[model samples]
Target: MGMTIALDAMGGDRAPGIVVDGAALALRERPDLRFLLIGDRARIEPLLVRHRRLSAAVELVHTSEAVAADAKPSLALRQGRQSSMRLAIDAVKDGRAAAAVSAGNTGALMAMSKFVLKTLPGIDRPAIAAVVPARRRPVVMLDLGANVDCTAQHLFEFAVMGEAYARAALGVDRPSVGLLNVGTEDIKGHEAVRDAAALIRDSGLGIDYRGFVEGTDIPEGTVDVVVTDGFTGNVALKVAEGAVRLMASSLGDAFRASLRAKLGYLFVSPALRALRQRFDPRLYNGAMFVGLAGIVVKSHGGTDAIGFSHAIGSAVRLVEEGTNDRITAEMRKIASPGPQLVAASS
Candidate 1:
């Protein structure tokens, strides 16, 4: 049977409509793919009728409740059993779908997904990993707001998952992994980061362990996989996003500064549009929750149909490539006796 993706049809800020439309967009790209749209039948059915092509490939599961945007994770965990988010996750856990996609409350989605699918064996906690467009090639960074506090061990696991993700998702043969820190030298970061770096360096886990990378190294494509705790990774991701937006905003202002500038805008518009596409967040909307037994992709809640389609595309990629299995294979390479941290010479 063709792969099916379970979707929370009423999860996002502009849901049901946007979700349906996004599914239609995805179907245009992958006609063999199928969808199980779980949400209000009344809201979803009407939209499905508008896209005859998508309607044939989709199956709607009526769900009356939805996890509220402001709902606390704990509240959703207890009260959202019948919600669209939970049901979508259930579809994946039940073997009815290959993966699940949601643009819902982040905390609630994570809570419910963990409760339903459970973490893969050997994983302490799931981490959010995403593809980043680096100068040389796409880079994979992990722990983007999944676990606010992570141990040195967690960072090591992130590296393992990230290396596999780079191979499966980005087609990197042997991805170079780096620990994000204040400086590249040994003894530059806190105990957790320093320890993680040392372990990776000496573990001989078949990973191309690059010593350490600073914040500036991310966009520079200094490493193929950047591993960090959730707190730092989230902050760095946000900063990079903000910087891109600022560049676009400044360009718009410069183009509208004067009549002469307007003339120049006409000549520069095409180049700027190309650059915008390269940095478009929608192209990289899907955030994969790694280290889970089942696949779950989180889309930005405020994203449009185009962005949501990309999230679904990401889910498709993970399912097709057996990303979880790849991660497991990589984890198996860690030596039975954990390697001791070897301090590098100053």
Candidate 2:
């Protein structure tokens, strides 16, 4: 049977319209794909009438309510039982859909998904893992604002999950894993990071556990997966985003400075276009909430139809690759007795 994805149709900035458009775009690429679009039917039906193929593939689930963009996670969880975001997540939990895709409030989606689907058997907490552009290829980084405070074991688990993700998503046979730290030295970073490194190295998990990696290593692609706590990982992600924007803005300013610069831009335009395509953030719009029992992909709230389609594609890839099954099996390996985990000094 073809995959059915649950979409929080009213969750994004351009609701119903862009969501419908994105679904159409995804369907064009994968004709077998079907959608369970959860939102206000009145607003969504008009948009669907425009796309004949998508109209045929989509099943609308009506809900008047939607979680507000600025709503707190706690408040949304308490009050948003009937909201589109919550209902879409519920679809995954109830097996109405293979996975749920939402361009909603990140915290609310995470909170609802966890409450409904719960975590996998051995997972303590779910982490947000996403692919980021790197020198050689995209790198998988985790805990992207999911758990601000993570223990050594949490970070260790993140590494395991990340490794599996890299293999499934990036098609790498043996992806190298690294713990993010201020320096690559053993004594660097706080207690949790140090302990996590020790656990990965000594756990007999068969991971390519590269000891430690600095911030530069992320863009340099020093490791296939970089694991860190939510606070640091989120900060690093934001900084990289800001830097990309700054570069784009600065280049535009330079290109428009004078007629000579304009001429120069034309000469280099092809190379620049290639560069832009390689580093385009829209291509990597989805962040998978790994360790969840059912698949839940978080799309960027401000992304366009194409970006949202990419996010939907991400959910499809995970479902096809059986990512969650791989994670569950790997977790079982660590739980069994092979090599004792190295305890950190207090």
Maximum-TM-score candidate: 2
Scored against the true structure, residue 33 in model 2 reaches a CA lDDT of 98
Write candidate 1's Cα lDDT for 102-151 as tens digits.
99999999999999999877777899999988898878999899888888
Off by over 4 Å in 1: 335-346
With a 3 Å backbone cut-off (N, CA, C), the pairs that clash in candidate 2 are none
Candidate 1 lDDT score at position 12: 92
- Model 2 C-alpha lDDT per residue in residues 38-64, reported as the tens digit of each score: 999989998988899999998999999
Instruction: Provide the lDDT at 17 for model 1.
Output: 79
Candidate 2 off by > 4 Å: 339-346
Per-model CA lDDT versus the true structure: 0.90, 0.93
Clashes of each: 0, 0
Query: C-alpha displacement of 338 in model 2, angstroms?
Result: 3.8
